[model samples]
Target: MRARFVSATPSEPAPPPRDGRQSAAALLVARGTRRLLRRLDFASVTELPLLSGRRADIVALSAGAELLIVEVKSSVADYRADHKWRDYRAHCDQLYFAVPASMPLDIMPQDAGLIVADAYGAAILREAPRHKVAPATRRAVVTRFAQAAAHRLHALSDPDAAGAEAF
Candidate 1:
């Protein structure tokens, strides 16, 4: 499914609750991964689109052909609740997990990469999405990244953004 953002004055009408913690976590992973990727000379973006039926949290592209998807979890419950994260297999070339700063460094999938991070900082302890990711999916990632990047860049350029600096 596709998701869009909407904004309205609170006095006009309270729209809907966008309690997209799942989507938020996905974006967090993307944010954290982008930080990690930059160290490796890569550009990263969050909320990469999917091919009709799938969605990815974070999408990162190295200067090389490298690509990655990161899934961030705020709680253990969140992690256990998602057992089929493997299904993301069809979409990303790499699968990774981003955990809260307080989470233990262990217990993550040994084969899969791990990124310890919070809202501000991220460290790449490991890098493993899956063994393989489709080429088309990689393109979808790039397209989504481009779109998200443009939106953020535009917002940052706006004078009304108020102290918001580009990351």
Candidate 2:
């Protein structure tokens, strides 16, 4: 399923599960990472679809218009099983791996940024190297991100509205 960003509020119902396959630890990391990103003045969405048919665990847009893609790895096996993260580099200005504190830091690739997170918050252990995305690709990704965020907000406001499931 495609990803949609949902805002949480006191009166609103909780958002649906992002992905049933995600481990509890991974969810904690994602939550903390999102909080950290917001603190850094970046707007982020989870499970955003990419042009390459891959779903990014988190996509953040900075105030300066830089895009970042973060892949959450809950375990060593999870990281080893997935090699698609390499493709994400082409879609963002920076690529990072977010993991729980229990995960071994050395197992992650040194080229990408590293983030250690828990349920409360996260810390960026290493900064990701800048990689300029093509103007065309940047335009497309930003468009998709905007559309998804808008759709999710609309859905939350009017759940019964037509095309709510489009995102």
Candidate 3:
């Protein structure tokens, strides 16, 4: 599927568009990525298939000859603890983690792909890395993920809707 996401830096307080304002880190990475991708000639799909999982966040896929998955992270703990992030590698031929530009990329695994982004653009810090995932408990995890994703998608598609009415 084509990912359809774009990141733009915020200029003024209460910017013209809500989407232009990204979290501090995302802003950095988005900016960083944009500058880097200038040399490449390819399109990117934004907010692509956001899988259902324990730590589901926005994912963007590269629109090109090859399949690429980019996972965006906003928190340090989430950076450390996103379980199904490992599973993402299974579905896609290429997988990567995207984060804010200023944050140190030192701690990230040397073999795992990385994207450093800021509000203006993004840059690929690392690429062509290896990821390890064990298959033992993935079935159960995927099942739970499917259910949660279905519910979350429903909520997003219908913002005015509410769950079973809190009483």
Candidate 4:
């Protein structure tokens, strides 16, 4: 599923009430990461798409212009079922996995950084090694972020946006 921005705004409606353990966990991870990244002064958009057709759970752009992609895993099954995360590296300067505190962190790949998160906030457990993205790819991702953010903002102000086609 595409990563969606969580907000109380009518344009970007919040996710439905949690119905299961996995959904609850995902909400927590996404909320926590949103808090964590903002605290670090990075502007982020959730559910941003990559050129490869995969959606990043969260895409953050730092003040220094570094791109960061976070993959949120709510359960062991969530992690195990996903192997496409590697594809995200090409679109980001750093890639990290966000999970709840109860998860077995040891199972996470040693190469990727880790974050321990709850509904209110998150802390980085490990810093992912930075591999600077190519200049062209960085430009594309940044442009996409800008467009998505703009689209969302426009939707927020447009009462008819609900029925409008996505850009």
Comparing 3 and 4 on lDDT, the stronger one? 4
lDDT by residue (1-167, candidate 3, tens digit) is 99754333456322211243346565445444534554454333333333333232333223433344566666676467655676566544457777874456776656558877766666676784644333433444334434444554454445356761110
What stretches of model 3 exceed 4 Å from their correct place? 1-24, 27-39, 50-64, 130-167
CA lDDT, candidate 2, residue 129: 97
Q: Write the per-residue lDDT of candidate 2 for residues 1-167, one digit (tens) a residue.
A: 99776556788644533657788888889999999999999998888889999999999998777999999999999999999999999999999999999999988999999999998899999999999998899989999899889888788767888987766
> Which stretches of candidate 4 lie above 4 Å from their native place?
1-22, 162-167
What's the C-alpha lDDT at position 9 in model 2? 79
Candidate 4 overall lDDT versus native? 0.85
Candidate 1: C-alpha lDDT: 0.63
Model 1, residue pairs in steric clash: 94-129, 95-129, 113-128
lDDT of 3 at 60: 29
lDDT of each: 0.63, 0.90, 0.50, 0.85
**Local distance difference test, candidate 2:** 0.90
- Candidate number that wins on lDDT, 1 or 2: 2
- What is the lDDT, from 0 to 100, of the residue 40 in candidate 2? 94
Q: How does residue 60 of candidate 2 score in lDDT?
A: 96
User: Which scores greater on TM-score, model 3 or model 4?
Assistant: 4
Off by over 4 Å in 1: 1-33, 129-132, 155-167
User: Which candidate number has the best TM-score?
Assistant: 2
Sliding window of 10 residues with minimal summed lDDT for model 1: 13-22
